[model samples]
Target: MGIPKWMTGKILCKTGADLVNATDPELVKFIGEIYYGLFRGGKIRQCGLGGRRSKFTIFPHMVKKLNTGLHVMIIIFLCVAIFFSLVSFGFCILNAIKVPYRAINGPAGACLWNFLAGGFVVLAVTSFMAAVKLHQLTERIANFRENIFRFVILEERFEDCFWICVASATAHAVNLLLIAISGIHFPKIKTKTEEVNVTAEDIMY
Candidate 1:
């Protein structure tokens, strides 16, 4: 004997179509009704002629939908990222001015290089961490929205936010390496001995 086919409308799954097909008819019908209408007491759908698939839910229009509060929140995060980046860049510039000194067991140009490098390393590491965290936070927020602009672009548009972080962090790290290189200097003795000049006479041939 052949199995009977269901005559109801095509089942759509919040999870996926397979799960929808697997659900019991009564529960399926109930969920379908809830998703399709029961909550709002409406049953209206329209077929598109071509291209864009736009499904409009009517209940939302009944009330004034004034605030896209989430968009502002994402903008705030972007500002923070920009702020940190600027601050990091400032430190890079700050390190560009070298105070060359030569004293064993004391300050040297290399010490300044190392100090600047440490700052770069710290910023780069923190940038990586911030990018990762921001991407994740955006991911969770993206799922709740229907539009991309309403959530952080780090998540809403990108399927996986971790890659976004990786790219941003890589660039920042490269920039830091360049900055570290820029801050390096040849050793110079800032301690004054009124120019001690050594000639061939000082060295025995």
Candidate 2:
């Protein structure tokens, strides 16, 4: 999902520099405050000294500054998660309306899709966190397209949008648990048995 336009306060990471420590006046001008929100497409606000403020979207504006590969991976995983969640919902509706095939009867189909969705959600969150921590995402975003001044990360934290994904993952887990608690056993693998000739003589022996 994309970031909401109204969610300006849902900052994912915040970065600031010590203006007093800057010896260069031009550098001090660029050193104020910056924060990035959850989605890359969301609005990122950069405030400089003397109340000079500029706003830009993170996707097209800061794409060059981010770890493009990891960022793309996170997006792909999120899309997949959404797809699987919808598939699970469809399965739930199917179960309520009609009798399904043996392979997907009861909670089995829903559970499978939920598991996949939860897995992808976990992957997305983990990859995003890795990109943020290992690649210094906030600092990169804060300093995007700037040649004169660089911003160091002063403070950073996961915000509401990140937690929303976490909550979705938790909901998937709870759904699976509820399915189990309802006494519906997950489908088990069945092995094929070879037919053998039975003789009365063997039994007598």
Candidate 3:
């Protein structure tokens, strides 16, 4: 019934008069600070977005901590999704190249090559999808030239790299999963066990 906490928390002005009287620089600063705070505050919660109101009993710091965790999860998931997608893409592409289309002289070889090509196409799609999700997860707030943290980091080129890496990493996870399901196993380490060897000289005398 009341305005959402995220909405209220984002308020930089209490009155219309204040907004109208504010200078351009002042307004920009206020808006920037609010965005910066929101970024630091973590992912906005469902309660903050207009669900059952957050319990009044919870302390502000606790709420902030919870939000921070939520944000971190979002980031971590996006990174993972991207990583998997790219892996899938790479496997598909590499396999597809193993048998060139022009070199395929028989139906069986051609069929296998087609299958690999199909896998490559599927993985490319997965990678593209992961990129889309990553873009949404970051809320597209990150910009290449603009520094979101302002004074902390110098140009924020990392933001651009992060987005690129995430997109590139997306679908390879499926390739790994398929390999696992196919029963292909990686080498396992063997541990040495020490057992006492009994000799005739040690016959329980």
Of 2 and 3, the candidate ranking higher by lDDT? 2
lDDT value, residue 133 of candidate 2? 82
Every candidate's CA RMSD: 15.9, 11.1, 17.3
lDDT of 3 by residue, 84-199 (tens): 44543554565566643442323333334334444444443444344335433122322212232211111111233333433433333343445456555668899999999998
Task: Give the higher-lDDT candidate: 1 or 2.
Answer: 2
Error of 1 at 58 (Å): 18
- Lowest summed lDDT across 10 adjacent residues in model 2 is found at 5-14
In Å, residue 184's CA in model 1 sits off its true spot by: 15
For all predicted structures, in order, the TM-scores are 0.28, 0.71, 0.26
For model 1, name the residue pairs that clash: none
In model 2, the Cα lDDT at residue 10 comes to 22
Off by over 4 Å in 2: 4-31, 37-48, 184-205
* Clashes per candidate (backbone, < 3 Å): 0, 0, 15
How do the residues 99-190 of candidate 1 rate in per-residue lDDT, one tens digit apiece? Answer: 42333212333344334444443454344344325434222222233442221221122223324434555666566466467667969879
lDDT of each: 0.35, 0.68, 0.35
TM-score of 1: 0.28
